[model samples]
Target: MKFLRKASGLLIAGLILSACGQQQAENQTPAAANGDTVGLAISTQNNPFFVTLKDGAQAEADKLGLKLVVVDANDDSGKQAAGVDDLLQQNIKVLLINPTDSEAVAASVKRANEAGVPVISIDRSVQGAEVVSHVASDNVAGGKMAAEFIVSKLPSGGEMVELEGIPGSSAARERGEGFHQVMDAQQNIKIVAKQPADFDRTKGLTVMENILQSHPNVKAVFAHNDEMALGAVKALEAAQKNDVIVVGFDATDDAQAAVKAGKMAATIAQKPAEIGQIGVDTAQKVIAGETVESSIPVELELIQQ
Candidate 1:
């Protein structure tokens, strides 16, 4: 009876030990390996720029054999916060966020910080949280480039309209700052009208129409993005105002086509694909416990026909 009891005890202990060992093995797997995932939260995929960014990230992830989980906020800050929460629940190793509203995304970023998930900011930045890295084009510089181009076209100074992006976005603020840095100095070139179109083509069209109603003599238009520029182009065409020099940012395919067709005068080419690719690469380094620069800037160029 004693011998049978000893054998039974040993068997139970062995089974428990074996189960623990299996669990430990599973825990030891590297996050980039196996089915572990990283999360990508984008401001919106409606824009071709963001779609290209997603495609770039997806391509790099596939190359590295890493699983990437993507979420589209559709330009909604509330939806973005909820999406971040969902990604956290899925045990994502890292989070990549392109914020719709810089200030609004702060709370979500803070939550990720507290959860010990490293965050990488893409395209736009977060106002009130710590980020492991930021990957984007230099909006300020791009804006300066656009302004310089505008100056070249309208050296004698003229009335112009500025189509703004969404309120509270870092990109908008920085680009506006750079534009004003140059335009403010030019006493001859006056911004007759400035309005926020919220980075939507439809909104851009409506806003341009309203601005034109009052500022019919506007000589040039500088849109913070290509979508707005394209919309402004349509409005100008409709109103039979063909002489206005329209300079846009983000040389998306459509914008490039417009430039080539002489519809848009110029645009700043921000390589969003490169930004997305570098973002994933940075995430991999972070996952491997490697240090990375706080800001990674992709090069920009002025694209014109």
Candidate 2:
């Protein structure tokens, strides 16, 4: 009887091992043996546009089987500075940064360079940094597209309002520069009201509400982002002044809905997903000690009618 019990115990152990092997085979995932790691420091994950970019980066990281760390700055430059410094402390192989303030992040960029961590600035650029690469949309071109739409929709020469984004952000500066370039060429279209909304819908709503009251005849408005554009629309609706044309940037889902409903006249779309993907791809190359270009410009699209 004792001999029979020992044989039965051995049989049970063998069965368990067999099951374990089968489970391991069935539940296999991508192996992360590349010994590569990357970190993404995004300004704010609150914005849908930035969320899309994060998703793209995550997807590419999984595909590449690289360890990826992500952190949100919540639109705070100080927080962003801390997060990047922390990532560096972890000795991450590469860094992908979507800066909060183009200028404020320059020091962090320099720090990453000092640590021998190659940085690929995604969407926004940091000044005076040894960045390995920059992946972003041509903000100037996108702004120009938005401006063209605004001019076309209000061609009879009317006054307009402008809502800008973060003060030191490349997107804000470049897009504003592009819009101003076009605005400079137009004689009849006057920018009577303008303010910085900080790319927030709530701020946009409040600022636009005040602007509308003062510039009641404002024929149109150009918001740097769909969030602000949506806010401006709500302000217009609440004040019973929905007739004014609104052109938004980023082509967010809300803005697209507004466009379809004829509430928004047009929007300039950027490929946030593509920017994230390219940023990750570049990060991987840098991790492998590979050389990459200094800038990777993304395409933009104009949406109307």
Candidate 3:
């Protein structure tokens, strides 16, 4: 009778141990039954644009009870690939990539697709990959808008310098291209100077300072991003060239304030908050195995304040 009792206790203890192990495994991930944990890796968090994207994706992950892993690539293509590899090893169910380079990041994206993790690209499109969705502003359209604003402000045409972002970036190329397409139609306006600032504030300032020396009659300046715009504005102010009209993209907080204060002429407002919100919403849909569309173009407003 005692031997029977001992056997019963051992069997019960074994059952209890097994149950505890199962619970631990479940706690380690966002999986529920057959559902899997989700992950989101982006190119860089150095820019506020990317920071907003991360926030939006995280909010959605919380609502759906899915694990969202965010890794910053630091604008390095190599680091971004490693981030994807790490996420895959973690058994991530979905991948949202904001690639450092459109074409260069294709190999890693292909690997993620092979791993069966659906990839949703945000901000910039990935070249040479089958992305589930691509979310970003229509940069070419935004560029055209900037040109129209310039024409309206300077009807008689004015000599201006262009502050471009990273030369090869799609945002920089398309926006700059659109600017010239409209300008090409107008024989009055002229591009006196152009230089690459690499989407950085300090570089923008230095480049503008140098351009001002060669083109002292500069009447207008267009920066591809707000950070660069802010930098160019400072240079203009220091040179006491307040009469030089300045326009910027990205509608960053400082740029908006500058517009309201009349220091800035206008800004192309990219709805970062909306972009972020949609990134999260789409990520959830992807995890649910529902198809989503690419070229998610958010609205852009010309803030003339």
Candidate 4:
């Protein structure tokens, strides 16, 4: 009887140990199953620029042996908020966001902050929240470059039309500011018409066409991005106004090809891929509890035929 009782006790002990081991395995983090996961929220993928940015981020994440979850906001602020919320449920270790609207994205940034998830802003900034880092090209300087290029083409000053990006975006505000800084200095150059095209190709075409009806004498055009610039080119071609010098930002593949083909006067090359890569790298640093700078600027260049 004593031997049987002792045997039963050992069996119960073994069962308890086995159950504890199974529970431990079940409670293991997802990172243990794969790797640390990072979330990326892009403003939109309609344009090739943002697509390249996403690709860059994904490649870097893969190289670092990390998992990346990408979400496209489609330029909708509410959608971006919901996307962020969804990513939060995935146990992401970090977040990299390219905001659709700088101010509107603040709410989502705040949520990430509250959840103790560090955020790294890419290409655009969040106005009301604290971000561990910001990675982007010098948009203000690029804007100044674009304006100067247009002035050089026109020389003695000519009426120009400006196709702006989405309202309330840092890219639009900074670029517009830089462009005006140059234009304000040169009394000979005047902006005949300026309107927001929301950084979209279709809107750029429609807006440029509308502006043309009012200011047919416009000598040059400056678009906040390549998408808009390409659209402007379409409008110019449709109107047979091929002589108008068009300057664009983001020397995307199409834009570079356009410049090489002499369809565009010039384009400011903002290495969007590099920006995306840096954003992910910075997020890793933040996750590892390493100190990082508040802002990191990517290089920019001017491309001409």
Query: What do the candidate models score in CA lDDT, each in turn?
Result: 0.91, 0.88, 0.81, 0.91
Worst 10 residues of 1 by lDDT: 27-36
Candidate 3 — which residues are off by over 4 angstroms? 1-36
- Per-residue lDDT of candidate 2, residues 1-305 (tens digit): 99999999999999999999888665643234544778899999889999999999988888877878998999999999999999998868889999999989999989888888888899988877778899999999888888887877776889999999999999899999999989879989999977999889999999998997788888898999999999999998898877888998988788889998988888888878888989988887776667898989988887776
Question: Candidate 1's residue-wise lDDT over 10-88, tens digit each?
Answer: 9999999999988876665354356557899999999998999999998877766578999999999999999999998
The true-versus-predicted C-alpha distance at residue 113 of model 1, in Å, is 1.0
lDDT of 3 by residue, 33-150 (tens): 3545766677677777667777877776665566678888887878988988998899887777877777877898899999888887877778888988888888888889988888
My TM-score estimates for the predictions, one after another, are 0.89, 0.89, 0.85, 0.89
Best-fitting candidate, measured by TM-score?
A: 1
Q: Which ranges in model 4 have alpha carbons more than 4 Å from their true place?
A: 1-34
TM-score of 2: 0.89
- Badly placed stretches (over 4 Å) of model 2 are 1-32
Better of 3 and 4 by lDDT: 4
Query: How far off is model 3, as Cα RMSD?
Result: 6.2
Error of 2 at 305 (Å): 2.4
